[model samples]
Target: MVNIDGHTILTGVLAHPIRHSKSPLMHNNSFAKLHLNYVYLAFDALKNQFSDAVRAIRALDMRGINVSMPYKQAIMPYMDHLDETAKLAHAVNTVVNDHGVLTGYTTDGIGFVNSLLNRGIGIKGKNVIIVGAGGAATPISMQTAEEQPKQLLIFNRKNGHSFRNAERNAKLINKSHPGLAKVFDLNDRAKLKAALHDCDIFCDATSVGFGKLKDQSVVTDPSWFHPDMVVYDTVYAPLETCLMDVAKKAHVKHVYNGLGMLLEQGAASFKLWTGKRMPVDYIRKLLLKSK
Candidate 1:
């Protein structure tokens, strides 16, 4: 356990249903290994408690906090400033408090891209298909566009705000990288099948594979997947998500859950807060061992 004293700097993650999060383990262990007088914790911030949670960052003189789920977009308004990526994604997953000036950033996209790169999967010159248009999907797609993928396809439900977000995100990506991105309704099975067949990377950024929907998958048909394509799901709770299982059933060689993204994003946040690169290799081994 890390020693807590008057000089210790505090950091944490804020989210509803936050008890299941592994962030504290990843960060606190990293701080311990680096011999830094920092401690990380997880706080369950309900809807009404969010504003006060943000205030506590300043009032308590804490270093920062990682935002997740319902708070990602909600906490942005409380931030003094949003970095370019945070503004681009319209979501803030990591916030650093310099004295009382809180600056927000979106490290999810960077983490997603870096996770793929670390796994020897390059996004450049490849066709990518991503499902959903919420927080995880938006940043992942935006960052994938930054990598100059040959074709970027985003799919979401046709009726909800997510569908509108899908169209909007595609437009934003196209504005900066012309002719690189396109949006489609996820229910269009024919198009989804065709895109999956042709894409090099297929990412499920939806919540279908975890929580109460652990057995559910957005792509029910395993035949849509190809052996040459990499499948990634932004759900790590069950380890082997339904999408991952589907991909494996289809004999896809590289199928992964969201654990890598979680680790990489936490590392990015740690860097922003501590100004030191995390011992990723050691942490990776530690996480795996814990798992």
Candidate 2:
């Protein structure tokens, strides 16, 4: 029986268009199964009211919260502390509130790393190329940078908002990461082409291949992709994004959708809130069944 008492721990997700989120389904089920006295909810807030909504976390005494879309970067200013991942990404997807002291963390990268490891692809000492540097891209970049790759090259559309964001974050991650993250304008096809020459792994951290732009591929030109290269797309909506489609057509040895990354990231937040190791396999089954 669902019960609410004075001791019930409140947790939730914050976003403007939150109804589309399946996070509540994922988190609440996990909570019920784990018997955690946590009730997760979602709050929809407009962009103008974002500041007030962030304040509501502490104002309402919420234990912790997950942030999504438009508010991830905007929410950072309100946070008291930011973990390295958040600092590098300039975004926060998870927030932990301990007696009103909110600490921000970015789990998107952790999820990507965990997903990559499970697929037997190692980022360590490997040259990497990431397309796009927006919301989905940044945290994954920050998280992947920690693995000590040989080098990290990110490309974004020239002078676009994400390219600007990526340019700023490129310096942030390189300060401590051994991989030496580099940012370049995606329009510079020659530069990106050269970077991908020795790339061991290339991940599409952009939404170009899916959503409204499902027909587009970031690397539209036939770029060089070796058989050993691991191709991944952060867009999970169509399962096989245009980038993944091209990779598959080229017979790339390993390819992955963003579903695993999404699950792993969600699992990371679950750990932060409950202090329990996630039932990954079980969660995987649930996600598959949902589809």
Candidate 3:
């Protein structure tokens, strides 16, 4: 039986729409299996309430916090420290609270890489085209660039925030990911189409085809995707995103949503909190079963 004691450690994910998160199941199951005195919860906090949320983490002495969309970047300024990954990505997805001193870290990039490797999809020497340069895309691009891909192309709409982020990321990647990273304007169909043609991997980091943009597709034409390509959409809420549905119609050999990445990042956060290895495969099955 599950029990909560006075000494039990508490953790949760902070997001605007907490109802859609499966992180509680992922973390709580691991805690239960390992017999750890930890309880995971989800807190639905709006953008304006974020500062108070962090303050609660400190005031309540919560063990950790998992951050999500709209707050990843917002939480950075409120954090006491940012790990190297979080600093480089300029975003934080996981936070470890040690005696009220919270340190932020980005597990999204490493999580994405681990998921790809776990699936037997190699990254080295492959050309990758990433769609959008928002929060989800930042760690993904950072991690992918580190894998030494032959080329890393980030496509974002012109005259927008994503374009500015992509431009900054290009300069960031050139530091250690050096010279292989490039940013393209999503408005330039000719450039985007060309990049897609040669890409071995196409990642959708935008929230198109989910939420309010459910009807929109990040890449309208499936013709740009080749049979040799692996299509991944970071939007996992709808389960089958528009891009994944189109990939299915095109008979693409490998297509995936953000589920694996989600699990991987969650696992990383769990380890950071508990200092124990997560049952990755077991958690994968739990999520798949839920789906």
lDDT of 3: 0.89
Candidate 1 regions exceeding 4 Å error are none
Best lDDT among the predictions, by candidate number: 1
Q: In candidate 3, how many clashes are counted?
A: 0
Q: Write candidate 3's Cα lDDT for 1-291 as tens digits.
A: 249999999999998877888899899998988899999999999878888998999899999999998788989988888999999998999999999899999999988898899889989999998988877899999999989899999999988877888989999999876688888888899898788888899998887877888778877787877788899988888898888988877778889999999999999999999999888888888899995
Each prediction's whole-model lDDT (CA): 0.90, 0.82, 0.89
lDDT of 2 at 83: 91
Using all chains and alpha carbons, the TM-scores for the candidates as numbered come to: 0.97, 0.88, 0.97
Over the stretch 117-158, how does candidate 2's per-residue lDDT look in tens digits? 887778999988888777678888877787888888988888
What CA RMSD would you report for each candidate?
1.1, 2.5, 1.2
Q: Which lDDT tens digits does candidate 1 get at residues 67-138? A: 988778888889899999999998899999998999999999999999999999999999999998887788
> Candidate 2 at residue 182, lDDT?
85
Winner by lDDT between candidate 3 and candidate 1:
1
In candidate 3, the residue pairs with backbone N, CA or C atoms under 3 Å apart (3 or more residues apart, or in different chains) clash, namely none
lDDT of 2: 0.82
Identify the runs in model 2 with alpha carbons over 4 angstroms from their true place.
Answer: 1-7, 177-179, 221-224
Clashing pairs in 2: none
